[model samples]
Target chain A: METLFYIAAAVTLLATLRVITHVHAVHALLYLVVALIALSLIFYLLGAEFAAALEIIIYGGAIMVLFIFVVMLLGPLAVEQERTWLTPGAWVGPSILALVLLGEVGYLIVAGDLPAISIQEPRQKAVSIALFGPYIIGVELASMLLLPGLIGAYHLGRRLSSEAR
Target chain B: MSLQDLIVLTPILNLGIFCLVTMLAIAFRRNHARIAAFAFVACLLTLATLPWVASATPRAVTALLIVDRYALLYMGIVLCTTMMVIGLSYHYLHIQFRERDGIEEYYLLLLLATFGGLVLTVSVHFVSFFLGLELLGLSLCSLIGYVRTRRHPMEAAVKYLLLSISASAILLFGMALLYFESGSMTFRGVGMVVKQVQAVPGLWLGGVVLVFIGIALKLGLAPFHMWIPDVYQGAPAPITAYIATVSKGALVALLLRFVTDIGALELPSLVHLFSLLAVVSMVVGNVLALFQQNVKRLLAYSSIAHLGYLLVALLAGGPTAAEAVTFYVIVYCAMTLGSFGVVTAYSREAGDAEQFEDYRGLFWTRPWLAAMLALSLLSLAGIPVTAGFIGKFYAIAAGVDAGLWWLVLALIGNSVVSLYYYLRLVVTLFGDKPASATTPQGLAIESPQTSGWMAICSLGLVASIILIIGIYPEPLMELIRTSVSNLLMVAQQKP
Candidate 1:
């Protein structure tokens, strides 16, 4: 189980790095989706299935789709001017930061006591209760937050269609 | 829920209902554009009820939100600012949309955003906190691009949308990590677990850093502040006012709650991180603002610097810090709203009065408007006999009490640097005359007959109140002290 966690974490970290460095927005978003899914799997392994589901739905599904839609809407012809990597100074800081973070996490994995993972335990029910019982207001608030975005999208699409006419 | 819960939550509910009613009215009414005026009146009425309701009952609603004096005070500030924004929106939206398109959606978004801010002020749990932040953020994205016909507005919206998503994702990831480490998601639950758990080598630090980045992004701090200028410049004046005031205000309120509820001050690394952010934000924001020619972009950078000052108070981390932060935010809301109001009031029909050159000779044409604009700019610069001065004083004092002498000095230095650009606008208003007296093409060229005395008087009243508060600050200081005491008491009380 611990080895699986390490593998998943490594995959996520590498994928996330690719997401940033990739020149194509669609490709970057795909990498992001992959990394997000992997991270969610790791969350489930850590006994947080609820967070894992939220990660899949919110980040992987809704947000990534939004990114892709926007990219498509902008069209590939509108790609920003590319700047070549000219200096090594830029890479040095990020590289050092990444190395330090990896080292710290590696130490924790080796030194800290591990919790056992149970595959069959019912964790979804707990999350549901938390969401609906004490967290009902939060769920409602999230819906309200999405309301304006929906209206804005509608308005944008309508204006575009009308202009095209 | 009891009467106290209802009382404390009435403003939020009222605003929410206003949003729904506005939407429905738009669906049914042909003259939906005029609903904003009604919405503005409704907001003012709602604000009037807040003091009565909050004082009548101050307690937590469902244990998730606290209805204390602090929350009520900020609620009043948010509501009043929203009202001013609505007034500003009337002229700006009318000009932008003309009679061809409906603008009821803008009012709906504004009300929702204000509601989110109200929730953020009172939220005691992570659930409400994240909800409020996102609601506030998503609405702002729409507001930023409300004038979708334009290139800059669309670009600004896209930039804000992309960066905001990244920030929210990081925030969610941090919340997940913290929950996993502590086996709890609520603020109190996290506090309890943090108290019991021994140090985890990487997770704790990474979680803390991620959370800090999230807050810093929302606050538009130095390193993470790339979206500020573009968004501010692209958005319509009224929406910009909303972003500058309510959106940032909510984020600060959430940051305050998160730090206090989670006992963040107990963590040395977090304190160091915040101090570092404060220093960078102060230095970078002021330096950047000095070079901006666009009034919108300048104010955006100024907003970033003002948030830095608030951070100084936040990092102080006690009752004094709370009082100073609350007071500073209140003053910030007033100054930002008034400044944006002036911009909205004076801008051309095409929103073309954005450049510094356009403001030349504004005083000669519109003396009262120019005076109010100058007042707001002076307050933002922290000049004596203005609310900004008192707020800055409180921040410096709080920083000193926290033994952060260097931060206080940095703040003072930045305050001095800020005065140059702020005064530039003031000087331009009175000193510089336009090259030609002829009308500039594309400028909104409002006739003297169209200048609404009611709007000017309302803004003048706000400017005067700011001055009154700045000169005789004891009453507001005492109110802030009570609010701070309540917040600290609640923070210390065990759930």
Candidate 2:
């Protein structure tokens, strides 16, 4: 479990680095998808299995598809813009910042102040129970929260309710 | 969950059902009046559920929501004002139904935003607050730009979206760090943890400051108030009123609740941080309004000053301060909604009823509208006969009681400065119209009889409330005092 966690962390870091460095918007989005999946794997290792599946389905799958759709909508102009934006010189700044974060993580791990307690992985049943039981108010409120976004998207996009996918 | 839990959560749950019902209503019929009626009924039903919910007071539904008296009072205030604003908006939306796209969604967004405001007032957990903030933000983004073809509304919505996205990021990051520091996501849990520690940790302080920044950004306080005037000028007057009142009021209530719970006012450094924010907001907000030609922008600056006054009272930190803050919020909402109600009535699609020129000779043309607008402005300026004056006096009293002399002095000075602008607006309304102003190119000011009287009636209702409160504030003051005391009962009783 510990080994899996470390590998997921490393993949997350590497994928995130690639996400920022990639010039093409499509490529960056792909890297983001990889990073999101890796982070979800870490979530699974820690015990939030429901959250892990959601991270994959929502962020990795649905949101990434939306990003691709937008990139396609932008068409050739976006790629042309990105090519100028992601020069070799531009890489130096983000790379330095990423490396600094990596160093900080390394220090935190090595300082021995970080204790690794064995994480108990709860089953899907318990997670669902917790969500639907006492915490059902949160579930209810979250749905209420999303409705406005749904309406806003429909309104601003000027799409008819009948035409909604 | 048990039946009792369901009963305790009825207010917010009622709104949740209303949102779904409104969605279904939209699908069933696209008529403006039907949708507005649906929204109005939903709002009233939700408000009526409050007393039922309050009967189950001090109930904590899970770890996220707390339905206490403070929450109930604030929720009632937010919902009532929202209902009034929605009525004022009916004629505005109905008139523009042809020109505006998705006209039915206006009521949907308003209800959603109201839900967000109510959630905010009761949120004891970071998750609930964040969800509420985003819900409010998303609805407002579309509502601000409901007239998509217009340039100013589009610009304003975009500005709101971009700035608030960053603000939410900072706020979330800060919440994460605070969670890391205390291993808690609830305010009470974090407060308990912090109370136990002898010396406050630096990381915790940093996170708190970030949270403050996020809140100040939303509240349109000084140093973070760049978006206020533009957004106010651009959005429709009713929405501007909604944003100014419902959006910021809930956040202020939340802030006060959190600070009181955490005993944040006791920390000298945090005190200084708040005092600094309060002083800067007062000075900058009042000084800037002195030069404004547009009434919306002028009101926007004055709103900043009003928030500053609340902060000063908040900084005072006592039973009196809490009561003052609550009473002031109700009065402030009434005046603001009334003033903007007048604006919404006269506004046309060709041009906004925004400039100083638009208001010139308003007294002669529409005496009732002019009377409401002027009285509201005078109330805002804190004249002796208006509710705003009593609100200001209470705020100053709270500050002085706490020995926050600097903030109190600044409050007095800013009130004087604000008077100049408010009086100027009043004088301009009574001034004779120039020939050039009477024949503007784009604007076609609707004749009073042709224009919507719904908005005028709403404005009249709000203005009367202000006057009533101004004359006899003891009843309102006593009510706030008791509720605030009820709110502090939990912490005080245990200790």
Candidate 3:
């Protein structure tokens, strides 16, 4: 189990590194999908089936599709034309970030609660109850946090979209 | 939810429902004054009903929020400060910006931000804490950039947003680490677990420090203070005051609760770390302010020093320190709000009267406004009779009681140094009417509607409170003492 965990962790890191190394946004998005899938596998191995499936559906599938749309809408030529993006100057920063990420993962593997998986699995029902029970206030507050972002986004684009502008 | 839980949550819930209602009202008929009045009345009604909230003391609404006197007192401060900011903005937002179509949304955003402060005060758990902090940060991001056409405000908002978002991410990482180390999410649970472990792990200490860094970023302590002045200068005057008082005050209250909950004082080294932050923030904030010509930026830098003074009381760590922190929050809120209140009133026309020269000869033309600004500045300088003086003295007393001489001496030295800038501003206000009478722009000159009178009247109210608190602080002092004692009795007993 420990070996499998380490392999998944390494795979996730490698995929994310590949994502950054790519010049094309499309290629980066693909690498990101691989990284996220690896993460879901880790979650599944940890006995959080609900979380693993949610990760795949929301992040691996839905969010990736959205990113692809944005990249397409923005024109693939825009990124493809920037062939100079692979310069050594850019790699210096990303390499540093990659090193920091590696350190964090290594530390978590040693000290974090990444132990062997137990047999008993908590189902989605329990997750719903927990969300709706003592933690219900968090759900309500989270919506409030997003409200301003929603209102502010609409207001921001209004001036540009109007005929007056 | 139970009846008790619902009632205890009213302060937060009221603002949230009204935010929605105001949105609907705006959609149906976008009337600025009506929407503003609706939002204002909602805030006032929330304040009115706070007495009822006091009846259900120390009730934990589920596991996330605990409605107690300490939280209630801070909530009252946030709500009152928000009310004053709203009153000021009502006038400023209408006249200054010609494109007033969606400016009404600013009030909706204001109520939401206050709701954020309210959530923070009552939060006992990390989830609520982070959510509240984000709500406050996100709303301010929009509010700071409300006047979109202005290049400076846009720049300030983006800077504030990027830094704040990164800070929040770092804070979440710390929470994750702490959860891993202690195997619990609640503060009391973390304290119990950490205490039970005989030799505390290095990981635990790392988590604690990481958490502190994230908070210091929010507090705009020395290391993370680069954004303060620009954000202050760029934001509209009323929102700048909001950032100084309600926003900072909520975080301070949360930090106090977290410190006491986790029994960080038992670990003397952590106490020393806070003392170190106190000294650095005091010296750095004051020194930085000495060079600033813009009054808003000056106030921004000065607020950093003020927070450092409050930290002196916090480092003292007892009921006395808590009372000092509480009283000074009130004094700080009144003065910052009043000083910025003067700025907001004079900010009706072309540009805000921010630069020191802009305020030159202000006394000659607008004596009443000048006097209020002077009084607020004096209070900020810790001059003998104002609220700032008493707040500073009490904090020093708290440090003395704790025998923290080094920090005490630093506070004293910084206080003396800070007087130069505060007096400089006051002297500028009273300086020989600037050569050739460079006419100060805005409010008094324009025959603005009742909104002008409303904003000025609110400033007058804050000035009176400052005088009352300064001359006879007994009433406020007694209330703070009771609140601190009530909260600390639980705080010390838990660990």
Q: What are the clashing pairs of model 2? A: none
What is candidate 3's lDDT per residue for B171-229, written digit by digit as tens?
89989988988877787777776678777777777778888889999899887788889
User: Which number leads on TM-score?
Assistant: 3
**Candidate 1: tens digits of C-alpha lDDT, residues B273-368:** 888888899899999999999999999999989999999999898889998999999899889888887887776555546788778778887887
Interface RMSD of each: 2.4, 4.0, 2.2
- As a whole number from 0 to 100, the lDDT of residue B403 in candidate 1 is 95
Rank list by DockQ: 3, 2, 1
In terms of DockQ, the best-performing candidate is: 3
Error of 2 at A8 (Å): 8.3
TM-score of each: 0.84, 0.88, 0.90
Off by over 4 Å in 1: A1-116, A119-124, A160-164, B1-4, B193-202, B437-454
Worst 10 residues of 3 chain B by lDDT: B442-451
Say which candidate scores most in lDDT: 3
Which residue segments of model 2 deviate by more than 4 Å?
Answer: A1-24, A34-57, A67-126, A159-165, B99-101, B436-439, B442-449, B493-495
| Model 2: per-residue Cα lDDT over B1-495, one tens digit each | 568877887888889788888989888878787888889889899889887777778877788887888888999899888888888898877665554447888998999999899899988889888988888888898899887656788889998998789889999988987898988888777677667889998888888888889999999889999999999999988999999999988988888888887678878999999999999999989999999999999999999989898899889987888888898898889889988888888777554688888888788887888898999999999999889999999998998999999899999989998999999999998998656535666243453334576676777789889999999999888878777887777645432
How far residue B127's Cα lies from its native spot in candidate 2, in Å, is: 1.6
